[model samples]
Target: MKEKQVLIVGLGLIGASLALAIKKEHPNTRIIGLDVQKESEAFALKRGMIDEIAESLDLAAPEADVILLCSPVEAVKKQLQIISRIPLKESVILSDAGSTKSEIVDLAETLGLENFIGGHPMAGSHKSGVTAGDERLFENAYYIFTPGKPKDQKRIKALQSLLAGTQAKFVVMSTEEHDKITGLLSHLPHVIAAGLVNQSKAFNKEHPGAGRLAAGGFRDITRIASSDPVMWTDILLSNKETLLGLLDNWRGEMDQVSEWIAAENREAIFQFFYEAKETRNQMPIHKEGVIPAFHDLFIDVPDVPGVIAEVTGIIGKANLSLINLKILETREDIFGILQLTFKRKEDLERAKECIEKETDYLWYEK
Candidate 1:
């Protein structure tokens, strides 16, 4: 039997991570990669994320048993068109890691690619590029597949077998269902976050202190706004119709809230927030979903020179890693709140135990 050859296009975070994950599980399987950015391709090759750099898609597609388009939605669509022109192996399973799937699935059907599957791995980092690739990036995350036809089940299973190394939970849904869910859970949130940031920017121009004052809560919610603007623009445009409807609904929601405030309807306002809090509190905290969960532990430490180092020293001594650390609220007179972020729940739990054992400081999980 021939050794499996997987071709990965776009050597960014998702692409590089996917390649690394595949290599980790199937060391003998040859991985070929192509990226528009020469540096990304070189980086992936040097880092052993890919076995070889493909000369072109046309040259690579015919040889690949599995082909994954890991680019932005628009780029994925263009690549689909390109791949449609190229002759692929009879058993080749084509898929993509685009966030939005409806348009891509429609395009695949239109292009006569019967074996193509629309995939979105619901996991990511704020960081991008090949340098940020990690083999465990998709571990325990949902990998949704939108197969265009009933007959594509065998091919979908084949693709899943190839990607089993990712350790992502597989989910199958219709393209329409996938789009509507993602538009609400992912794309719509990004749009709202960006809109909030822009509105704050306009306000900051009129009031200089406004931006600085918008720190903890505002920064937390708008963090996704800092994502790659070009990528978000492509995603928002690709799911324009769904987002348009969502935004219309969002406007109606805002109008209701505005009226509540205007009419001084205290009970209505309280019920609104009460329902939102109840719904939000019911969401699974530790599970990785469409949005990444932050396993954060907050420590209250003295506002002194060595306090941060002392806390970090404890975590480091235990051979634990922190995703990020920030001083949320600090003052000379009061204990400073230090935020420690972990990628996994186990790490967070272990870090908490270490902090408790090693320090006298008070810590809490939020």
Candidate 2:
């Protein structure tokens, strides 16, 4: 078979990771990269993420079997415009890793590009740039596709084959469906997190000690607020309609809670909390369908030397690797709460049991 050529425009985390994954799986495939930053191209080449740099879509798109736009949402739209003017291979398939799908998909359709599909990998890190890219970044994550035609199954399958190394679960849905769904899950959460952080900043400016007294839970909830402002700004503008509607829905939910509190309706408040707990607990703890889940164990342990090492040693001795382990909440006067995350349920269960049996600490599956 003739070696397939993949042209990745932009060498940011997602673009570089895709290139690395493809090269790892199919070393014979010709991987071409296009980026405005020459340094990114150099970095990707040195790390074997891409075979060569094309410099522009005009040179790359014509020879590419698959072209991936891994730029921010606004840039993805501009690239689509450029792709519309460029002469591409008849069989060339185009896609993107943009967060907003409706705009990109609509633009592709308007451009009369039959081979273009919109895709978003529902996974990312707070880290950015080529140096942060990892081949396993997309493993077990959901990869959503919004194709122009339902019968574009062959093209979808071809694209999937090219990205087989990602190990991502494929999901096909309409552009509108994707926007609404992601707006609720990803976009809205970012808005809320940023709002909370901004609220804290305003309060701290007046109170003067609030920021210094902030704890782990506050940082954890507002972690997403530290994301790149430029990238998030583009995403929010692109998905404005869906996000606004979601915000209104969230406001309604908050108003109901406020009313219950004002009325001193204990049963209503208890029922609300109980129902929310029940619903949240029913969510899958392992990667399934479009959701990427976590297996976490929360433990309360004393603050002392070797405490972390001792806890990790037990899991390590059991031959179980942790995805992430951290002291989520700690205070000088109170027992610290440690949270351990594992990629597998069996590993999580084993870690919980190991910690419970080895120490006099309290532990539970989170």
Best by TM-score: 1
lDDT by residue (42-151, candidate 1, tens digit) is 99999899999999998999999999999999999999999999989998899999999889999999999998999999999867899999898999999999999765
Q: Candidate 1, 354: how far from true, in Å?
A: 1.4
Model 1 stretches astray by more than 4 angstroms: none
Error of 2 at 362 (Å): 6.5
Query: Model 1: what TM-score?
Result: 0.97
Worst lDDT 10-window in candidate 2? 285-294
After superposing candidate 2 on the true structure, give the runs of residues whose Cα lies further than 4 Å from its correct spot: 288-302, 309-325, 328-335, 340-363
Tens digits of per-residue lDDT for model 2 on 298-326?
A: 88988877889999899899998776777
Of candidate 1, the 10-residue stretch with the lowest lDDT total is 149-158
- Give the whole-model CA lDDT for all candidates, comma-separated: 0.91, 0.85
TM agreement with the true structure for every prediction: 0.97, 0.87
Clashes of each: 0, 0
